[model samples]
Target: MPKPASASALFSGPFALATLSESDGPAFPALVRPDEKVLDLRVALGDPALTVRGLLEQWPTVLTRLHELASTERESGESYRPLAQFRVHAPVEPRQVFQSGANYRQHVIDLHVAHRAPGDERPEQERRAEAAEIMDRRAAQDLPYVFLGLPSSITGPYDDVTLPEWAQQPDWELELAAVIGRPACRVPVEEALEYVAGYTIANDLTDRATVFRRDMPQIGTDWLRSKNAPGFTPLGPWIVPSDSVGDLDDLQLNLKLNGEVMQDESTKDMIFGVARMVSYISQGARLLPGDLVLTGSPAGNGMHWGRLLRDGDVMDASITGLGAQRTRCVAEAR
Candidate 1:
């Protein structure tokens, strides 16, 4: 029996095979070479030294071999190209994209602060109405405050993000994206995290007018228009397997707009952890491999800054182990 592959192995390059290209179609059990190039398993398997069958039959073994190769390179002082050399697309074509809202206490307070005037009358009726609004918003921002983005919107590493004309305040969110590894239905909270295959970085682009209004339905609801603007979700770089990143709740997340830090917070601040979220979402809907769950964003969004993204603005977002994604904002084509 061949040894299982390590996380680092799957990402190393120079594997005695040609690199895979996006035009080649679906890649199964592929390798990301150190030079940031993709190596198709079908092509690499042709190499006599690393004998393997199809992706499903040999995924574990392939990972192990790649791990060994990566380790050898590290010990021998062999340097390879950076991850930027390889173009990255979504690791899996997901069926659904779920997101949470107001999952942080500070975020909740911030919203209240942004909505109310200083020294405004806090009458009992108004307080009840606000409390009711908050409760409704909670459901609207539940564990998997879910929404759908057309698959056509998906882009890979270093892709340009176009800000739609109506998106006056396009904001950046540094979020931890969980990729489901297996089919899960009504999964218990204790076993929810087990269903995750890996994690990635997601920029939850928002049109403040839309999300805010949608949250306060009495004010108005334009969620579809607000949340589903074209090129809104810029995901990728690569997916890092769950095992490679230990302690899901302890990771630090950061967002840099232009060259300045905008949002800095830890996953520890999350009111609902990943396990609880997975379990809550899977109650009725089945979580298939490649389905993405974007845990909520922290404070310091552009709306909070009283600014909006202009053309040529650069945004970088990263989680501890998951790699960073750099994107530039461009004006939508007229």
Candidate 2:
């Protein structure tokens, strides 16, 4: 099981939150400490029906109460349990997941140049320069490319991902996920951050082979079959409140596959920041509490290294303030 780091590095605030399941009971929300101890919010707040999404729906009020709860020392008779006794699941059950694609400048350029047409014989530097220019134009004028992802595809941060047999080239795209705190529609870019409750880490696993529809050249990408397999999205060790996180642009995103560093970049490389992506998505779809808007991954995906995921490979992904998540890959049975 993956454990959180020390208090000084793991979280910027008093505590973070997570969803956990006991041996014989259903999943419940809890306040997690860096010391590996957890206090059940349902029992502490005296609301058994309370959930992470429910808390987010009432974010403003609940956040204040949470601050108060976090300030004081644990009182006698309070039920605090060790984190290891339970299973940690995705922090929130989002009604919708908005995924931003090609939002990172270098990532887009790298992919475009790497997957050049077979017959096209352009010098490597020339191809890269052309791709970079296109990205610059898109960043200045074009709107962000956003798509939907199924909530059912989410799995625990430390769970084993079952790679489907049909997926020939499974790849990893670790991204920063913004958790929405309130209902937002047609929000402006300047005000989009206000609707974000917190932040978490998400690995958006994709099957490279299924990315584009071979049968229909004009139809473009097929994200559903490429990305929405069960356990494809491994999200959260916990959520750190938005206020606790520092400048979004300064956050460092790093991912290691089988103990080798695959991705090491800062959010500064993103063409469209979190605010713009959120604002753009809200213009079309209503973003509800617990909804996740995944900012696109930075450069250095599996494709960049010409190496894709295989059975038994483990991916450890993390962002600056948010905690880390580890997922081991397993092959599907015949």
Candidate 3:
């Protein structure tokens, strides 16, 4: 078993939104402030039924109110408690999850060269140059590759992820997830940013050995089997409001495995930016409040490092101002 990692302050600036549970009680939405204090939204908003998704449903108004509450200085009382007393959860319960695949410019090129087909005699430099050109062309003329993910796969930021007994090459893909606040259908690319509620982190785990269907080669990739296991997606420490997270295009995503940096890249390397990805997905399906659209992971995945995940390994994933997640891995009981 992996040793317990000490908890650190996950949120920054004035405040962020999170879901926390006290003992075994039900989880409640909260406003996380500085000094490791948390305010129960049910008590702060006077709505016992309040949830993170419910708050996003009324985002514009709720945001203003939350800002006011975060800015207020108050004495510790029934409404507020020390954050250490509670267990943190995935910030929002997303109704739908749309994940982008191979959307990073250099990540795609690297994968292409790394997984060259048999009997290919081309030089590595030549293959790399070809791959780069392919990515450039795709960026200029192709639609983003997006896929669906089940919400059941979501686990808390600090939860233990069970590596299925059958997994041979489990790998991690730390990504930036855009939380949707407003309902959107065929929204223009320019207007897509207006629908984003905030940003959070998601570690999209995959079993590389099962990613392709060997039995039926023509069927292509098998995302369902390789990426949707329960606890495969460790999401959120919290969601930082969009207004507070400036320069979405240049935000950095850093992932460390067992305290060693593996993936460290900027959002500027994405072939398709967040707004383009959201706008494209909305053209086909209506994006609802609390829905998550994961911007693709960057280079330096385990496959690149020749070090896939093993039992007892810990992954620390973080994005810009969205907070971090520390997920410990354990073998699944047979």
Candidate 4:
């Protein structure tokens, strides 16, 4: 006979919750009061019956029950501990990380000027030609502009961002990252959202000098290097479930550089929205559970104004209801 489920079973490995108390070290279910730590539904509910593959297969039921339990505990005045006591990690190991580039109209224009010759035609004509070419390339490229990042590039919320000494122009890209929940191949644009697990914030850091080299091959390997620098992509804080963020098209996103608002825009402004990007990318590659796709960033990136990140800079990026991610920039230790 199969063993029945118990509260203890829920808190076992593969599913465990931890609390961050101001006065205590990290507290797990076995080490401290289950009620005292901040609720980590993914960690708090583990099932021996489910294999790693099966866990996501049964995620809906598991997540539903987990949320109910956590909410109930919170409603009862359980005196839950604070988040300051412990740090959070990436909730899942993403199989692949896909990022988009130059997807915003303003960003495209900015790049044209930055990359154009000093006297490359009249400014108005150059802008028009560049815009038209970008539009034309969109149809020809067909595929979404994607670059891969090493897992080492990813860091969790509240992590420090290391700026390499050679990084002359460090910039921040505030983007929405969607986590794939199911295996999908050649998914239609209309049905793409159904495969999503949730959304989180992503900072697509870039080094301008390396990316905008005029002598480098435009369509070759250098493009990838510029986009995939180490410690370039930072994600997390929480994976706001898809259901919780209804009408994905309407959400507002913002980025603050040291308490000053920088990028502020709505998802509605995206030239290629999430659904299309997902469906298009899937036609070329299969998306699996924990795989992440970063929808492109909006205008207002520091690169446009010749302002790059420096040591001691703080970046706080957030999406509506999804929570915020903050990172402090420090010089790469010599």
Candidate 5:
């Protein structure tokens, strides 16, 4: 119950948070090392609390303690487990998940141009210019488009993603996710970063074919149908602290499908940055500690490749400083 230090100060330390499963058992929270090994956080921190949720709830009070313990264990190099020895779980089981949509400038333009009606064809430069203009105007307006995601969709970073039997064109959207540590409601953009607990990598899987409700296209995107499949959201390798992340705008989002680089972009291209997205979504609702805000995926989705996810395909997604996620795709059993 101490006054929360600025995110810049909190993240300046070396500690990060993560969850892991041992022997295929339940998940436990741990302090993820910057290089290798996962320190048992519950015991490392002297156990005033437990679970990833506990870490976030008391982050302000324990941030310094976390740094001290992690630094000692790391420097001492004692009782460490190799990163690959255990199963990495979703960084946290969030109660609410907020996802930004088409927040990447180029990603939106690609979708616009790629899906344009045949009769609306125009020169590539012309189309690009138009899209750029729209984005510029939108940025001036300062409006962000966001949607809800189900907590049930979250899974381990290295887990298997099951392509539901009904899904035709499942796609991958590699994104940077912000973990909210402090509760926020109606917080202004300037003060929003203070509430951020950390950052993580999230693959916002989508079912492209079901994106729009054909019966009610006017009603807009069907986020639930398009995004909330079980294990659809592959999150984490680690929740790298916000200050540790340096500049959110410069983080590189890279996703390789079967060794072929598909999505390569910087968060600089986001139409609405992390602070903006968090502030916008927290207008009326309280963003609780441990809540996740996914900052939308960059372009190069399956729709653009004309090659959606297939059973046995492998996806490896990574963001600068936040570690990587490798998920194997499998067909859902009947």
Candidate 6:
């Protein structure tokens, strides 16, 4: 079972929002329920520009209005539709994407152990201890590793993930993505949580084979070639308002590959939580509304299993309260 939020952390008015393109029309904002029913958010907000980014930019006021509407018109039978009725797009067309790497203690350890990299020359217990020590030092020193991702790689949660032939060892990384509401520049860690509008699920798909440049090993990892494939970042069934999501660190994340559980862990294991990641990123660059910060995935990726994603494979990623996303993988055209 998922952990509950504290009394102080509970949302005063609970609701989530999404973007969907219905009947081939332009995308519109929609209020989402955990049961998967949705309603036209524009009708509730009394606005026509049904864009999630617009709502996020004005979240301070819009959130209040959204709560009111969610209370009154929600139970009433008006404008609601089964989530399947609409063609879902990536919930937000984020202006920028910041993806975290090696943010999960167990995930990094799994990779180090599985690949037997230079650092793994020591015995199992010794290597694990060293890795844990490094993570502790990083947390104590207040540092995080973040990378840029192309917005063009974003795709719908339920969309098919097309794998390019160049990617031999394609993998899945189910992550919890933070959607920014307020612009932040060097925001303090204490005030950083307020900048979050909501949370969504992101499957940060990767190609394990290309992660390290064999030709230029000294140049280091190549996030672009390994992770920025078309539709590689499958995001959102909906963005549950951060307030409504309860305890940020206690949420559970699970990913299944064809009915088998591949990744199952709690956000409690995150070496860097949402607030820290946000505050750290803000110090280096300004974070604008609707920009995404993907907290890294937990352990048990395909790479750890020595079984990469295959053509026609299915991935179902779920984060407690935030909702679940299903993506089927297909080989790219030759």
TM-score of each: 0.74, 0.96, 0.95, 0.79, 0.91, 0.91
Worst 10 residues of 6 by lDDT: 1-10
In the range 77-123, model 5's lDDT, one tens digit per residue, is 34667656677678798889999987999888887777676588688
Q: If both were scored by TM-score, which would come out higher, candidate 1 or candidate 5?
A: 5
Best by lDDT: 2
- Which has the better TM-score: candidate 4, or candidate 5? 5
Ranking by lDDT: 2, 3, 6, 5, 4, 1
Cα lDDT tens digits, model 3, 69-167, are: 887655334456788888998899999999999899888888888777879989989999999998888888968999999999999998999999999
- Model 4, position 79, has a per-residue lDDT of 39
Candidate 4, run of 10 with poorest lDDT: 1-10
Among all windows of 10 consecutive residues in model 5, the one with the lowest summed lDDT is 1-10
lDDT of 6: 0.84
Q: List candidate 2 stretches off by more than 4 Å.
A: 1-9, 75-77
Q: lDDT per residue, candidate 6, 31-119, as tens digits?
A: 76544567787766667766899989998988877777655545443656676677767889999999999999899888866666754
Q: What are the lDDT scores of the predictions, listed in order?
A: 0.63, 0.89, 0.88, 0.65, 0.82, 0.84
Residue 147 shift from truth in candidate 2, angstroms: 0.7
Runs with alpha carbons beyond 4 Å of true place in candidate 1: 1-29, 33-38, 45-85, 117-149, 212-221
Q: State model 4's lDDT.
A: 0.65
Superposition error at 62 for model 3 (Å): 1.0
What is candidate 2's local distance difference test score? 0.89
Misplaced by over 4 Å in model 4 are 1-37, 40-43, 47-57, 74-81, 118-121, 124-129, 136-143, 212-215, 218-223
